[model samples]
Target: MLNRIIQQFGLQVQSINEVEDSHSSTVYKCTLSSGENVFLKIPYTKLKYQRELEAYEILKGRVSIPDMLEYWTGDEDCPGAFLLSELKGKPLTSKGSPTVAFQVGVLQAKMHTIHPPAEKVLNGIRNEYTNWSHFIENQFYSFAKDVEDVLPPQLYKRAIEKFEEMKHQLPPPDGPSFVHMDFRPANIIVDNNKVSGIIDFESVRFGSTEMDFTKLYRDFLCLDTTLYESYREGYNSIRTLIDLEEVLPFYQFTDAFNSIGWCKRRGMEKNALFLEENVSIIKNFIL
Candidate 1:
């Protein structure tokens, strides 16, 4: 199948190397005949291909996303879907530099400028909200249930009650924006202290810009506070509407729950340590 693809594109296949393998997909680095580099992402399931393709289509020409060369569905030759695009530069972490976080913040700010279909955006949020306080009562409570076994019952109860009490203080959700639901450093690629590209649009959904920002603060900030400040500067430079103080606690709580859930799912001892530490941090702030 790969041979046929190379032949159709009139390119020689020098070598194919596995880049990253995950539960959903496996990416390969392929050097073409003209010495050009490209990446082929093969998904484990057919459903993932459709979501990725839709996301790519929506994001193309609107942001610093990969250029899609070709996308194909299941066939006798290739059983699942594949995406071909010019490979971007190395991930920010590869350089062992701290500036990448600032670049990510800048890129995220640019991404939020994109506008997805409005009705779709509204519908997605409506589906998640059951009432006026649904964000706190339903969403956070549901997340807590998933990690209940690992959490301190008293602290967990206080966190939920505090969130419920504070729920009314939150302003109405902001105007919808194109949000990369999973905006982590891993999904970003950087070179020369600048973001080369952003990948992994599988979780692309239209919602509050804070949803994206919260993920950034949760993951990258754990490494360095300076990085978080840098990112905030970049983000604020592009859009000034975000209320950082109000959202900080919510993000902290969400991050704690998310970390515990991840640790439980992966059964990783290091993640367990992280969960405990972050839980302590959240408790300190809430109490």
Candidate 2:
């Protein structure tokens, strides 16, 4: 299958190195015959391929994202893959610092400026939504199904109540905005302490801007008072930072809840530590 793609594009390869593997995609750094380098990404599902394809189109000129060089929508025997221009940098670790947090905030604010693409720019994307809440609600319902057997009855009931109670209270962005639904420290690539690129757009969608800040704050910015303030300063430099005090807790709670479902789908026992962590987080939200 890979041979067919390389042959079709006439990609004369010298060396191929597997870089990152996740539930959604298998990525590799491939050196071409001409000594140039590129990334080959094979998405685990068709939905991920479509979502990322549209996302790259929306973000190419607006921010520092990888350029889509070539792609193949393969058939039953061959899975689809993307050949993208490489963005050189080391990915930040999960333990984010003030510098990483600030850059992330600045980059996210920049991304918020990108609205939904013109109809002409998109392919047939099945994931389009009218409002961000509907998108989130749909996600909650779906995740709920995956973890119904695992979460305690009382916690599960309250989680649903919390989402129902707070989901409606959250406001959409001033405009329909592109959100990196899975943004985190590991996804941010840096060089010399500056953000060089933002990768992984498979989970990208048009959603509330505040929704984008959940994982960033939970995993990084909230680590220290100075880090939180620095992130805000960086974000404010690009565009006005929205008031999160009123709205952030809701997203935080739901994100933690969503994490449980994520673990269940992958394998609860293998992801037990992460699963335990999210369960602890959910308790904090309810308590």
Candidate 3:
């Protein structure tokens, strides 16, 4: 199929290599004869194919994202839609550094400046809670059943109960900003110690800037005060003061459950001790 696409585009395919395999799709790097590289995302579902294409088109030069070359639905005759864009840099996790983190912070702050069409924004948030406390409560309750065995029985029950009791004590959501809902390190690409591109827009939606920042807090800082402060300092270089207190509890709760899901999917329970620490943090800090 890729060979057919290369031929159709009148471009020579120098090499093709599988980059990453996600539950949704298989990503590949295709080098063309012109010396330019393109990233091709092939999803298993037609819906995901359309969503990713829409996201790429919506974000196109507005932000530093992969440029879409072509999209076509695959069929018994065709196969699957092929997303082709200029191959960016390596993922951040593969090249960890403070400079890359700072660049990521700046890029994210810039992305927030783009407001999606107002109607789309409203529709996205229509049924979603705009209050921080309620947001935390709702996500916890929704995932509680799946995470029961991951947490201590007593702590899990207490956390849920505390969330119920304290629902009204939290602050309202801040002004809505464009949120890269899954802005973790793995989704960002860095080159020469700087963020060159960001990928994985499956969860892009209008929401609080905190939603993006929380991923940094969980995956990068992990409760390290100095690192957290450093990230905030980098972020503030582009934006203004941001109070994260209201979002901290939500971050803790979501990070715990997210880790459980990640571990289960990856079959890495050998790190059960690491998961135990996450639960402990949720109990002491979030509960």
Cα distance off (Å), candidate 1, residue 130: 11
Question: Candidates 2 and 3: which is better by TM-score?
Answer: 2
Clashing pairs in 2: none
Per-residue C-alpha lDDT of model 3 across residues 95-130, encoded as one tens digit per residue: 366666667667777777766555443322222325
Please tell me which predicted candidate would have the highest lDDT against the true structure: 2
* 1-287: candidate 1 lDDT, tens digit per residue: 65555555565678888885243576778887778788777665555665677677667776788878876666665535454676466755633345666667677888787665544433122222223345435556666765676767887677667666665667666546777766766777776667887887655655666556665565566577777677777777787648867876666666666666666665657556776776787677677
lDDT of each: 0.65, 0.80, 0.64
Q: Pairs clashing in candidate 3?
A: 74-79, 74-80, 75-79
Instruction: Kindly give the number of clashing pairs for every candidate.
Output: 0, 0, 3
By lDDT: ranked, best first? 2, 1, 3
**All candidates' TM-scores?**
0.74, 0.89, 0.75
User: Could you report the Cα RMSD, in angstroms, for every candidate shown?
Assistant: 4.7, 2.4, 4.3
In terms of TM-score, which candidate is stronger, 1 or 2?
2
